[model samples]
Target: MVRRWQPPWRRWSVRNRLMAMTAIPLAYLFFTFLWYAYHSRLSEVREELAERGPLVAKVLADSSEFSVIARRHDDLKPTINGLLRTDPSIHRIDVLDAQRRELVAAAARAPGGTAELRYYEAPILKRLMWVAMLGPDGKPYQKDRPAASGVTVETIGYVRVTMSPSALLLKQTRRFYVELLVGSLGLLACVLLAWQLAKGLDASLQASMQALREADAEKRRLIGKVNTAVEDERKSIALEIHDELNATLIAVRLEGQRIADLSPEGEVRDKAQSIIKLALGLYNSGRSLVRRLRPEVLDMLGLEGAVEELVRHYDSARSGCRFDLQARGDFSRLEGDIAISAYRIVQEALSNIVKHARATQASLSLALEQGELRIRIADNGRGFDAALASAGIGLVGMRERVYALNGSIALETSPEAGTLISIAMPIR
Candidate 1:
């Protein structure tokens, strides 16, 4: 026979399976949460960089406009360096003239090679204004004319700021680690709870199985008691018939014979002869009934002789089936219940063969070995479908008897293959 393969989880215990089932989903959820949190935090970091980079560039442009117009580049270095020192995220700052020449530059030390940089720019503007309305006498010239004034804005320089996100990324990474730790702890707790639940279920199942076994044992014990009681009743009935009915029939036969001998060749003698014949038939029937109820040969010759006598009787009946018995080992000291159960099992098997098998040959084998009695009954009959056929009373009785004695029985049969019954019973 080839064994089929099963999945690895199929072989796991209930507790393990339950824990795995619980943990897998929790782990998935944890990973999903981490993924969402990482992306969300990254977006926040980007937004902060966008807002802070532009504002710092604009402020530097406004502050450096006057210095750039006066061509005092050296004075602007201190402010640019101070801005870089205050914010570690600002990687570099540059001030350029109208021709895009770097007039002053300040840079902070780069934290890592992989740091991402963002750039923001703002233009430095100079406002020029023209003044009119100056009369020759410096006095107000009241004329019905609107005053004309003009102002012009000109780009003088530009401020460019470079920013890095290494600090924000580090902070996000630390937060993720903390969340992962908490999620792992929660998943482990769920797995432990699942294990505990599985343990409880397994314990309950074991208790139920134990109860069932005890019930089955009690049932077998009750069956053995019933069988013993029935056998005792049968023996009592058989004794009554043997001692009372058969004796009465024998006496009636003797009286009829004497009456026939005294009355010579008359109607009375013919009637007496008929009476004697009827009495003899009744006596023979009673004796046959006694043998069936309780075979006396079992007490005299033990189980082997009783079974042999049974087989011989069946064989002599000429029921179109040949019966054979093969015996081994001594059965003299066999236990009463075991012997009787074994004999009854064989008897039932043979009866079934004769009444239903339509077999040409049947064999019974008995062996006593290692303090156990083994019996096998086989017949070359047109066997029925054992799976489909409802078990007959004879088979049920045989099975109950064997089970009551803590023995085992197996029946093998199929269409056109014949039937075989194997049984084993302890001697003690």
Candidate 2:
């Protein structure tokens, strides 16, 4: 699965991916932190009010007794109003009698729609005959007496207080808004940072890839130039050996024959004839050697005829082997190097067939299509595995030469089957 996806991603340059990889996590981490912090802090603010609501209600209950028993509705305001002024969290307060009815309720400020309310109740218990007493400092104190000692006790009322949580949460909302702002800005910065980092990384890698491609092209060209030079030198050496050395040996043989005809029919004439024969042998051997190095017919008969001559020579030397050549288009008009490379490829392929194919017949085809020179050589022989046979120096050389010409070569073969070598070279 990974291999299947690799090629498509390669189409998007390296930089874009790197930036996305870098920025996404940072923005995600920041936003997650912001989300967690906002809810957690907001919960804390709400909890503070939830815990404090009951405390504020209980405090109001403890002090509401005098206002409730006196039935002074106007007097209940002062007690609640003082506490409201001290703590802003309690937005409203109410003192009710024991009947669960409204008595005196006071609000320092109206609770908004979103504000929460809390209720607390405290009971007022009746006392004995001496209900209250005064201390030495003239402060009122509660005194309790038994009801059984001719004392009557009566129930008074209850105090109910109401509280609001809006005032306590107002300040926390401001801090939460600030956190949201910072988190948004931080997320933007992370995206920008990742984009820049990806661009830088991609640019460097692309530059390196281009440099490597150019270097590889240069190496191929250099190798091609060297191969051309070597071939030229071989041609020059072959022509010199075939022309100069062959001529000298032939001239010497003619001179020896002439000397033998003028001599008497004795040991001297026989020795002269032997000399002529040896010189003639040397001349023939040197000519053969030159032809093997560089086929002279290539310059005379052109590419096609030269190839046929090679095939004919091979057929003569090896019995039970016939080479059939089929051609389309004019090979003689092809570029010199292209033609030579094609001939050499065919030569090498035929050599492999003779040395290894173990077949009686081989077929070679040359065709021109869409400005490309196509050559196919096949042999009906006991062929070896193409994979294993490719390790041979002959095939390697053929492949290298074709590569230098910017051409392509392919081989098809299996054990006990025939072999086929297909090549294509642009004919320009």
Candidate 3:
């Protein structure tokens, strides 16, 4: 089964393309905006954590009730243990002195100095750096050594905190990118629809133009029929005049001859001879007129026979010039209309050859080869400008006939070179 095509308007359009272009940048900007917003939100969360973290540490450290009851305030012992045990927001917390001794921390029996320092330095210190930066009042806690020389001296103690916010921001940003990409794609689809609508309009206009051309061709065909009818009528009238009037005139001339033989040496005989001469010239002129109207040989014989006859007639009639006719391959196999058109072209060509081409020899060739019928009329005569002669009615008529048969005609001529008319008609 043949599938029906959708109408042009139904197909994709330029609006779609334009929308797609805008959507790409819009998506990028949207994603960037969301990324910045998510980052700002996370940074805000982390910053709040930084400021409030120290306060939480201080409260745990200085709380007198907890220090007395838990026995944890002597060093910030209760602060570190309470923060780590309760709040999940805090990963780990450590309280250290200026001497790098662990003042308080969970998971150890006594105060940790060197061994605790080694443990915190590797994992705990690295984690805390992201969650907070030390304030001016907070002491510089040496991560590796308890008392390395050349370090800042005017310090007391510090509380360290560690948290995870990078993973949190990444999860939120991924959601925003997905949403932004989807929205951009939706916008692109809308634009595509609009563009397709506009393209449909252009396609319809082209269809209308094609219809108009077809209508014009039909009109031309009708016009051609009318023209052929008028030509047929004129030819019929010319033939009637030649046959009817000329036959009667010939009969009268014969009767005049009989009377002139009986009365020789009289004015009657002289007048009779003059009348006969006049009648003969009139008959000759009538014959020429009939031939000009249409060659009878074209009707009596087919194209090939008529063309050969015309060549022979021209050879005798115009003895000053030589006309050669050659045929190769099957000329008889050509379509009737094509053959007739070819013959007319040759007739007009020879006429021009005699009239303008001041040459002594002209040749006509007709052949068929490789599915194309070829006709060539060439002369060894002074050639004229091809461009100028193209405007001539004879050449134009030849072109029209050739065009009707889906064939082509070309004139090959230069000033010194002879004129050559070549026609190629596709036969298969």
RMSD of each: 15.8, 16.4, 18.4
Q: What is the lDDT ranking, best to worst?
A: 1, 2, 3
Where does the lowest 10-residue lDDT sum fall in candidate 1? 139-148
Clash totals, every prediction: 0, 1, 6
The reply for model 2, stretches above 4 Å from the true place, is 1-209
lDDT measured at residue 312 in model 1 versus the true structure, 0 to 100: 93
Q: Against the true structure, candidate 1 has what lDDT?
A: 0.87
Show where candidate 3 strays beyond 4 Å: 1-205, 208-216, 219-227, 317-321, 329-337, 368-373, 426-428
lDDT (10s digit) by residue, model 2, range 173-278:
7887898888888788878777777767777888898999898778768767877787787788888887898888888898899989999999989999999989
Candidates 1 and 3, the one with greater lDDT: 1
What is the alpha-carbon lDDT for the whole of candidate 2?
Answer: 0.77
Find the candidate with the highest TM-score and give its number.
Answer: 1
TM-score of each: 0.56, 0.53, 0.48
Candidate ranking under TM-score, highest first, comes to 1, 2, 3
Query: Whose lDDT is higher: candidate 2's or candidate 3's?
Result: 2
**Model 2 lDDT-worst window of ten:** 141-150
